[model samples]
Target: MTNATTDAMTDATADAPLGRSAVFTILTTGYTGSTGPGVAATVSYVHDGDRHVIVDPGMVASRDRILGPLAELGLGPDDITDVVLSHHHPDNTMNVGLFGRARVHDHKAIYENDQWTDRDAEGHELTPSLRLIRTPGHSREDITLLAGTTEGTIAFVGDLWWRPNGPVDDPVSPDRVTLRTSRLRVLAAADVIVPGHGGPFKADETAPV
Candidate 1:
């Protein structure tokens, strides 16, 4: 089950005036197996005005898992304007080439074609309703994408918590303490969370602290 956390970032969208709506859909729900090699990245689609964003289009059972959902939403790869990678792990980046025409956003900067423009990710606004914030933990370069959707703020956090029923202590995090701190920060800002390897869930008391 999912949980609900306090809303500590209502002001984040104060500047996002009315009528500007950002909507999102979970294209694929990822999973990790206890044995064997089964795994996939949870992928998401976000639309804010003219921007069509694909988040974490990583390893899937098949590319159709990502594309089929987009097609159902009336969008194609060429229609995607941006792609956001929460971190650089192959599971979170392997399918990046699918959107060759889109600009890519990582923890560091925006990349498009052959140009890699470097910039800090903290509070970087992709649109008036979506932004990026540094939340390094599972990896020193990890970042979270915060989207102000009609349902409230949703955070696409990579590996911070693999799922709602989290691996309370991240097994691969370089700094457990830092991961916990980042978790708290994300819990504060997000009303809903789309974890790296699972379906989206509400942020609440059950969140790892």
Candidate 2:
């Protein structure tokens, strides 16, 4: 995952467009580089005016390495306000509970009552300024967040698409495919996109149109 916009078209969403000025440092980048081998995951961060969140923290394989980099930025897990998982895959959610007292903010598809559950496709309002968009294909729980307004809408898509070069992995479920296509239309109309695995991205690059 290089940048956000390069993530995917369908099965994704965006929320209010946050500015670079607000983003501070990567609490951690779980892993970088390509998959396989000694490569691990990378964790990144963004500052919503003092409210901090850490999206998709990688596995233990290399999560420790990311800590050093985050320290350089003068931040730790305790400093985070929320922990947002892209989806339910353990590669990203295995160590999710290790963080501080930040309440997890994920899509309703995978989010159970204090647990992760699977459900049919449906959209809901996550917060006052964000819309939780459901994008099934990748296990039905795959969801993308859409910001309230274009002024700073950032869609945090988790595993809807791969990094640098990858497409949304569609499933055989006709129902899910139908939902994915519809979500693509929404992606085409977003502003900023903060992907789960990659960095942040703008709207136009991956818009389905």
Identify the leading candidate in terms of lDDT.
1
RMSD in Å for model 2? 7.0
Per-residue lDDT tens digits for candidate 1, residues 9-50, read: 333334222333789999999988531388899999988988
Instruction: Report the error of model 1 at residue 191, Å.
Output: 0.5
lDDT of 2 by residue, 41-153 (tens): 43555455455666666564655655566667777777767666666776667667656566566655434237655543245543455445566555556666554443545
Candidate 2 lDDT (Cα, 0 to 1): 0.52
lDDT of 1 at 202: 85
Off by over 4 Å in 2: 1-39, 109-131, 147-151, 168-179, 182-186, 199-202, 205-209
Looking at candidate 1, what is the lDDT of residue 116? 97
TM-score of each: 0.90, 0.62
Question: What lDDT does each candidate get?
Answer: 0.84, 0.52
